[model samples]
Target: MTLRLQPVRLASGNDDSEAQLVFAGNALVAVLTHLAEHHDGEAGRWFMEAWFGPGYVLNRPTFASLDKAQDWILERLAEV
Candidate 1:
């Protein structure tokens, strides 16, 4: 079972803007984080508007290492 991992671009960059989302997706699901850290306005914005919902606020788990990143992605699979 090969996972088709693809990078996710949060926005088109040309100037000083928030960094791209440090997240990826496979055929089954996509996992995301606030990028390098949490409380990231842009990342949080994308999660709320795109994946989760207006009222949903995902904050507890964040990617810190390679293993954690993978876990984060798997954890979000249920939502997808």
Candidate 2:
């Protein structure tokens, strides 16, 4: 399966505005937000802000990078 990421800025009214829209084919799978300095240890990581479909829910995990987030999304998609 092929996944595409579109860079976007979320109007979260905070430092956590940088985000990406994750798409699987024509369907939107998830939204990933970049953690800010306020997150302390998690700062600079990518956080799963939202998700669609089954198997996509995983307690809104944070990834060290965009690649890892995409990998996790693919794994979840494969399970369904």
Candidate 3:
């Protein structure tokens, strides 16, 4: 299976903004890990919101392997 990376632009007040994306699972994890390690809390939160959506519900087993995560995302995409 192939995973796609789609770009997203987020607006933060007037003139301020940030850019992010929903990438292939591995890519997503890599990006998040980098942000978590390097960026401050607000930046990390912004990235998470873009990736998971604002009303995202986090259940148990909050994270998964890249392949599993990609599959899960693809399944959800199919539903929409």
Best by lDDT: 2
The ten-residue window of minimal lDDT in model 2 covers 52-61
Worst 10 residues of 1 by lDDT: 45-54
**Model 2 TM-score?**
0.94
TM of each candidate vs. truth = 0.33, 0.94, 0.33
Local distance difference test, each candidate: 0.38, 0.92, 0.40
Query: In model 1, which runs have C-alpha deviations exceeding 4 angstroms?
Result: 12-28, 31-60, 75-80
Residue-level error in angstroms, candidate 3, position 38: 16
Clashing pairs in 2: none
The alpha-carbon RMSD values of the candidates against the true structure, listed in the order shown, are: 7.0, 1.2, 8.1
Across 1-80, the per-residue lDDT of candidate 1 in tens digits comes to 22343444455343222322333332333334334234455333323213331234455343444355555445555455
lDDT per residue, candidate 2, 1-80, as tens digits? Answer: 98999999999999999999999998999999999999999999999999984654657899999999999899989988
Which is superior by lDDT, 1 or 3?
3
